[model samples]
Target: MTPLHLTATALASAVGAGSAATLDALRQERSSLAPCDFEEIAIGGQIGRVRGLEQVELPAGFGEYDCRNNRLAWLALQQDGFIEAVRGAIGRHGAGRIAVVLGTSTSGILSAETAYRARDPATGLLPDWFRYDGSYDLFSLSRFVADRLGVTGPAMTVSTACASSARACLDASHLIASGVVDAAVVGGADSLCGLTLRGFDSLDLISPERCRPFDAARRGISIGEAAGFALLEREPLREGGVALLGIGASTDGYHMSSPQPDGIGAEQAMRRALASATLDAADIHHVNLHGTGTRANDLMEARAVNRLFGSDVPCASTKGWTGHCMGSSGIVEALIASLCIENDLLPACHGLETRDPEIALDLERHNRTARIDRVMSNSFGFGGVNVSLVIGRPAR
Candidate 1:
């Protein structure tokens, strides 16, 4: 796998609106989770809700894309000078050579949810202003991002549940390696809505308190919303920068929602990623785990990690800080790996208090400093989709 440098990255989640706020939260060991309050969702669990999507306004020409999801994307793009970096890439590669690949699970489905309530009584027709292509469609985010960034190259959205955005990065790497594009804007945005919250509640997977991934007392996930983006280039903007080294994707087809019990799928994904990166397990410094705090998920991932990296790998899950952002989980956590590499910090498994007796792994509990050169992020989603990414400092 040809390494693709992540020249610039940005994030907007419950932790805060940009990478700086996120960094501050990580530095100060803060979590922004609050009681589930959006749209009067009658759920008991806490949620990582971003504060200002209602005030977000799309540019005048892109008003058709006005929805919570796209608004989240707009807010994220304004952060960390990410837009400026994309423009700079366009300047060098030309608009036709840059691609926009984003991920989302319920792309503005809330718009449709709201529209259903306003339907004409007799005909059950939605509001005339509602446009599915610009708002509710799965491709809306990518289209909005590509049009906003003024890029004309290949643009698409990946929607493989939670693995969507990580897979987006992998797909973008393929585009660059195949000479299909010179650069790519890869990330995703997902906004909170009643559908997801209630959906999880129905599955009995919502945690009443803040999620504690890999904790002995862990109960379930805390639903969240976030948007994150990174500029992936053929080469680093400068020397000694974090770059994408390898990617592995697999599906076990074991269950519709639950992960495979033995973790064979997770282990295979991590092994394939290492093979693609041409490195051994010993070369990995840390692992950003996909510990969702659900009983089955955390245990299954633990089994997988132990089988591959052994119990010694310093692993952690940051979901307690931002809740589970669902589709955006891939990009938010993947970018967190880059943040760890850049800052040389290992984030705490935010709410980990006591280790689970059954899931034995070297789960990180407190903030620490270490010489981290390379790391991996695992994103395994529903219906057996799995993806693992390896990120490291660009080779000298």
Candidate 2:
């Protein structure tokens, strides 16, 4: 796979509104989990809830796209001059030459929940203002963003659970390689809602406290909301940018929710990513793990890492700082890995208080300085959808 240059990136999560705040929280070794205050689903467990989405205003004509999910996407797009970068790309490559690919699991389903509650007593009709396609459609996020960004090229949505956005990046790279587009806006956005919260609770995957990814006492996941975006071009818009070197995707079909206990699927994904990148596992400097804080997930991922990279790879999970942003996590964590490459910093595994002796992973306990030239991020989703991405400093 020819590398795709990451020209620009931006994110908004519970840690703060922009990448600068995210970097600060990482530098301070902070965890952003807080008590569950999302809607009326009175459930136990902390969540990575992004603040101020209620205050964000959508574009005047794009009122139908009003929802927590799209608001977060808009907020993220406004950060770090990402919009300007996209505009510049548009100027260089005509609007028809850029593609828009986004991922989301719960795209404004909260709007549907709200409208369902407001149904008329006799007819059971939702509020007149509520349009299912406008807010609740699975493709609404991608459609709204492409319209707002004035991207007229190919546009698509991905909804492969937690691996959604990371897979979107892979899809974008293929589009560029196939000469279908010159550049792509790849990212994802998911917001807090009662549906996802109660659903996880029903699955018994919600933790009562902040999630500890690989701790011996680890229990379950802490749900979070976030939006992240990156602009990927076939060539570097400027020198010294991060590049997506490889992407590996596979499905284990083991269980609907639980990962393959032995991590065969996870192992295959990482190995395939290495093969796609045309590099050995020894070339990877750091890894951003899909450490969801669940016992089964952490164990399986650690086993996979051991089978491949051994104990030498510095590995950590940033979910403690942003929570598990569900589908959006893929893009969020990928951008964080890019930030690490740019700054040469390896963030500590935030929630691991006690190491799990069964796993041989070299968990990062604190921020460390390293001559990191290449990094990897793994996004393994429910229903056995797994993806691994290799990122590196642009080759000189």
Candidate 3:
């Protein structure tokens, strides 16, 4: 399969906006997880809440999409000529020639929750201010983003738990390669909401202390919210950013909520990605692991890494710095991997301390400065959905 080139990528998360701030935090090994102070349902552990969404003014016409999720998407698109890149792709490919594919688990549910809370007692109905019809639909998010960007091509949403955005990347690549579209606006966005917080709380997966991925005493995961966008084209536009070498996806058919104990599915995903990239496991220099800090998840992923890449590849998970941004995790982490290729840096695992005795891998305890040429990012979600994306610097 011909690799689909990624022209540009952008991210907005708790670590900060743009790649510079995110890479800075990664270099410093900073953990941004702090106690959640939101009044609605304050669960302990760090969250990647954007610091100043209140101060950001929306464009005059986009006031209706004012939730934190869309707000962050708007803010991220404003960075480093990202908007221009999308416009350029549109101009080159024509408005109808591009497709839009987004991955999101919680799309506009926060607005629905707000409306549900603001029901008028006198009328027994939602207030007019909160009665917007598209507040709770998942497709609404895709439509909102497509309409906002003037992208008239096929628009679809993928909601396969945490692997959603990663799957979006794979779908976009196929669309562009198959002559379905000339370019694709591929990414995802998710927001914090009371239902998610309480649901995780009910499952007892909310960690009180800061999340410690791969730690010997790792407990559970911390929730987060983010929005990431990447402009992908079939061919390079001038100096292209990085090439999406391959994407591999699988489902374990194991437990609905837990991964296979021996990491069989995860290993298959990584192996498939490497094979699709036409590279050996030894060719990968670094991996952005899906270290959610949960005991089961970390252990399974560690075993998979050991089986596939041995213990030589320096690996780390950025969840400690950005928290687990759920559906957007794949895209956010993919952006980090792209940045690693762009800057020749390997980010440290923010919260890992003592490596688990059961897992054998060269886990980076501190920031490592090296020329990273090839990177793989893993995103595994509930229901055994697993996705692995391999990205590399364009060959000169």
Each prediction's number of clashing residue pairs: 0, 0, 2
- Alpha-carbon deviation at 299 in model 1, angstroms: 0.7
How would you encode candidate 3's per-residue C-alpha lDDT over 1-396 as one tens digit per residue?
476777877788888888888888877777667788654475666676778865776567866666666776777777667777888888898989889899988887787788878888888797676525344677766777787788899999999889999999888888888888988988898878887788888888888888888888888898888889888876887674688888898999999888998899999999889888888898899989999998899899999998888888999998988999999999999988888878878887877789888878777678788988889899999889999999886566
When 1 and 3 are scored with lDDT, the better candidate is 1
Measured with C-alpha atoms, the lDDT of residue 130 in candidate 1 is: 91
C-alpha lDDT score of every prediction, in listed order: 0.90, 0.91, 0.83
Q: Which ten residues in a row have the lowest lDDT in candidate 2?
A: 233-242
Cα shift from native, residue 392, model 2 (Å): 1.3
Model 2 global lDDT (CA atoms, 0 to 1): 0.91
Name every residue pair that clashes in candidate 3. Answer: 33-46, 34-46
> What is candidate 1's lDDT per residue for 370-391, written digit by digit as tens?
8888998999898899999999
Better of 2 and 3 by TM-score: 2
Candidate 2, 1-396: lDDT as tens digits: 888888888899999877788888988998889989888678989999887789999989999889899999999998999988999999999999999999999899999999999999999999998878778898899989899988899989899999999989989988998999999999999999988999999999999988999998888999999999999987897778899999998998899999999999999998999999999999999999999999999999999999999888999999988999999999999988988888888989998888999978888678997778888899988889999999998567
Q: Model 1 segments beyond 4 Å from truth? A: none
RMSD of 1: 0.9
